[model samples]
Target chain A: MAEIIGGYFTSHVPAIGGAIQRGDQQTPYWKPFFDGFPRVHEWLAKTQPDVAVVFSNDHGLNFFLDKMPTFAVGAAAEYQNEDEGWGLPLYKPFKGHPELSWHVIEQLVADEFDPVTCQEMLVDHAISIPMELAYPSVAEWPVRLVPIGINTVQHPLPSAKRCLALGRSVHKALASWPGAERVVVIGTGGLSHQLDGERAGFMNPEYDRFCLDHLASDPDALTRQSIHEMVRLAGTQGVEVLNWIAARGALGPAAREIHRNYHLPISNTAAATVLLEPACGVWALRRRSPRP
Target chain B: MPTPPRPGARPEPIPGTTLFDGDAARKGYHLNAMCYSFNRKENREAFLADEEAYCRRFHLTAEQRRAVAKRDVLGMIAAGGNIYYLAKLAGIFGLNVQDVGAMQTGRTVEAFRQFLLDQAKGA
Candidate 1:
């Protein structure tokens, strides 16, 4: 059986990313956010995982309206985080585990997920931002990366269920990898937000709390809602929550909530992080009815 | 606006990486937002009239110019042209790259542009 080394959830907000890149992590405003993850930091210091499955949506960097791919996987040798200048010092590019990554890819294809495969892929701030948060120990991070790029911004965004299904499939793929050990799967995105137009700074703490509650109990249930409702209640950009579904689905029905944190920083958004640990077996998932 | 490359300019692969060459892919998420935004028939007239001016405004590089000139969709990406620019080229060539990414995970230039604008501000 595949041993899920727990899962992590976070956001790729550029402001937070900028703060880290500029080396201003010590700033008072950013302190609470960092402190909230003491358990997460401690876990990383202890496990020092060998691989991180980063699920991030791409910026317009590679996928635009003309040729956006919904689910593209990066099987590159190295992936770099762009320091969009807000002072996050540029870090060395993260190396990838192509062998294991490809194995998982082959398995997914066999399982019927038509994943977009790429050898040369450019990851924008969206992916990089989350990496900085989850693995600050870049110089010595034990994790090799497997990048899963999603298209969250363009039209025809994946349904929440689609994102969740992708996550579950990832688990199926990982279970069959040969000799690959010590892996962490991360789902990153939003609690609530609207980063565009006159409604740019919208926030919904109520919805954020409600969404987290639903995800912990039954992510599959949460995945059934439409993006329109999310935008109306949570804000247009709040649709980012769809990305989190991918993470939640991978945790499976038996996933136990380890740590959860949600906060509204800079007024326009609510950022949250959740951790899930898988235990027991597929038998539980097969026999279980989703809890609400 | 710069004239279209005269015939026979020997279209080269866009100067950077594709989804295949992970070793040297995009240097940064840095992109020209105007490219994708202006890549529509409605906006094509304005785009052509002020192409060079617009490229300069966005601080686009020479490589990007060649990518757009050749109408090399993949090259536009490999050569460092931003989605904003590539989208515009796609508009001209009648292709839609943003839809491609969307089919998988659902995305749009507006979301990307917003993210970058946020970075440009916070950075």
Candidate 2:
């Protein structure tokens, strides 16, 4: 039976994508931010998980108010990026693992998550920016993807508790899959910053550090936050931390933190990344030696 | 003008500001749909070509049209425009999210940026 091996979380900021597009990585302003990702690249090179389950929120690319699902699973063979009003030059198509997607959807529904499945989805910067940040391959991305678009734009977003439960459901689904392939679940958004109203440009490094310090040992502490508290403390878009809760839940309570990085003022947002490994000795450990 | 409550539901304001609930969505439907059209290059060009004509074509309300005309980010929000869609319109004027943010907060762009830097350094 398949089991979730690991999890990763990071921010998906368009400015980072913009910096890369303009070849500004070596520039003084962006060098430190760019410097942080090589460690992630090294992780990807070592573990090389076959599939990545990316949990991200769209800014405004694919689903408009016409029909926005709280949880959307893309089961397409190929996912393309839509021009999100202004032309973001780095838009590119990502290959999707439809077989794994369909299976995950089946298991999620069985577990009562009821995700809306899309055969055709135009991913926006939310998905592309992170893909580029982690993989950065000139050719196709190194890992096959299963894009799970979470709703953070619209009100009535899934609560942090619900998001955590949803992540647990996804982990159960992956563990039940018949394939022996290694899979990595990723949550992409937020380390506390807001982008709207008079309270815009809000950043709380203390809040961010508190959350990060507890992510591995006490994720439930983060889950206890109400949206009102989240808004007051982290800003509106800062609610995207629900994605991180969900990602952490997928790895179960035994997940061990392997890496972490945090930075601020990444285009009016505090950005963070954490890598985790499951402690059951089931996935990564089993790979090292045959299970006795 | 206060909108009448819907048949079975009433819209509640988000604690801090106006919520982008169903009522706001309805009130700003045309305004937002018009903004969404800016995703295309030609639509952006057409809007730049004759702003009034474009606003009229979208049947934007006087308040919304005036807000758009003056590039008042906060006014547009007050007129029920969601920021995501409003961002498309902001883009046509070469204003980034941070610029629109500064306008909403009544700060100059440089001041707002400095404020961000300060906040990062703050307690």
TM-score of each: 0.68, 0.91
lDDT of each: 0.62, 0.80
Writing each residue's lDDT as its tens digit, candidate 1 over A131-232 gives: 678777557446788888777665456778888888788877776565647778887777676543234344667777777887766787776666545556
Task: Write out the backbone clash pairs for model 2.
Answer: none
Instruction: Give lDDT tens digits, candidate 2, residues B1-123.
Output: 999775534233334344466667778888888998888889999999999999999999999999898998778877878887898898888888789878978889999888877775664
**TM-score for chain A of every candidate model?**
0.88, 0.92
Give lDDT tens digits, candidate 2, residues A123-161: 888778877888875587766788888888776677788
For DockQ, the strongest prediction is 2
Backbone clashes, each candidate: 42, 0
